[model samples]
Target: MSERRPTLRERQRSETRRVIQAHAVRLFTDRGYDAVTVADVAKAADVSAMTVFRHFPTKEDLVLIDQPARLIAERVAASPATHPLVRRVGGALVDAATALTGRDGDEPAANERFLLDCLRLMVSTPALRARHLDSQYALQQAIVDALGDDTADPDTAFRAQAATGACLAAMHTALTRWAEDNGQTELPELIARALAASFGDDVVATGRRD
Candidate 1:
């Protein structure tokens, strides 16, 4: 027989995973992360607690699991080969933001609200906060590896880490400010302003080089 594709069992497993994640997010949002237990998620998902754990090793993983790590990696990889690493990464971020915002705009606003709620939970819950920071650090390291120069003595690793950290900090600051402002302003605009301020004229100059 030819190599077997995903069987019905596999499909069902995948669906179960999605359902568990959906229920977990709902419980986290409604009851708060700490208040919601694995049993609660299981009840909401109509699955057993073991199934939930099978999908996500920890409760915090459920919240952070769907983050777009692969998408970010792909965006960085798709940048112009001739561009400087920092410029390429920055351009990739802009592109990612545009892709995420959607054409009509309301979708992006909804997403921002959801993200804000998630961040707020992370901040209030110690375990979730630790997991969030750990996840972010891992992403930063991945970006740094993507930007590293093979021939440079000390390498561009430090710059990559700094740039990625700065970008993330800018976005977090913008989101927190927007949350405090009662969602009066558009998140994309705030993000753009933050990027401009952080990167200054380098953004324009970098774009021109391409």
Candidate 2:
């Protein structure tokens, strides 16, 4: 007989990972990142320390997670080549915002709060801050890879870096402003305005040039 696939068990395990990560974030945010040991997190989540380590190798990963980076990469990869990288990235951001907005029945408020918590942790914790820089560097590499080697010459690389950096800066700035504004306006609108300010009318024009 053929070996049975473990799809159901795998999904249960995946859900467990998410649960552990969620509890870890809650503990880390409520206490301090440095103050919360893996053992403490495991106990809080009702899992063993080994189980926590299985899900997140490092304490920092507990806060950083993987969904956002993976989603951004997938979006970039799936975008059309006819569009400029800037427009493609912008469109990806819009898609991400829509996903977060719960138009597809996902919980936007909860996800927003999770992002806010992540931003807070990344800014406030030294270890997490370093991890954030590493993540951005990885993102830069991914952008270059997506653009392809033929298009990743020095000039193209520079432009890609600048474009990605501008978008990230705009995102951080918008999120900060939104936090200060008590989230009066939705994140998507803030993100759109920020991107427009960064790219101006030049997005299409720049992309069309030889």
TM-score, cand. 2 vs. native: 0.81
Which portions of model 1 miss their true places by more than 4 Å?
1-14, 101-113, 148-153, 181-186, 201-210
Candidate 1 CA-lDDT value: 0.68
lDDT of 2 by residue, 61-169 (tens): 8887566666666676777777777876765665565466442244347767777677777878999989988987777667657666525578877887777777777
- Using TM-score, give the best candidate's number: 2
Would you list the clashing residue pairs of candidate 1? Answer: none
Where is model 1 poorest over a 10-residue stretch in terms of lDDT? 146-155
lDDT of 1 by residue, 28-131 (tens): 87878878899999999998999899989888888774445555666776666676655666665555554554434443455555555666667678898789
Clashing pairs in 2: none
Task: Identify the runs in model 2 with alpha carbons over 4 angstroms from their true place.
Answer: 1-6, 101-108, 149-155, 201-210
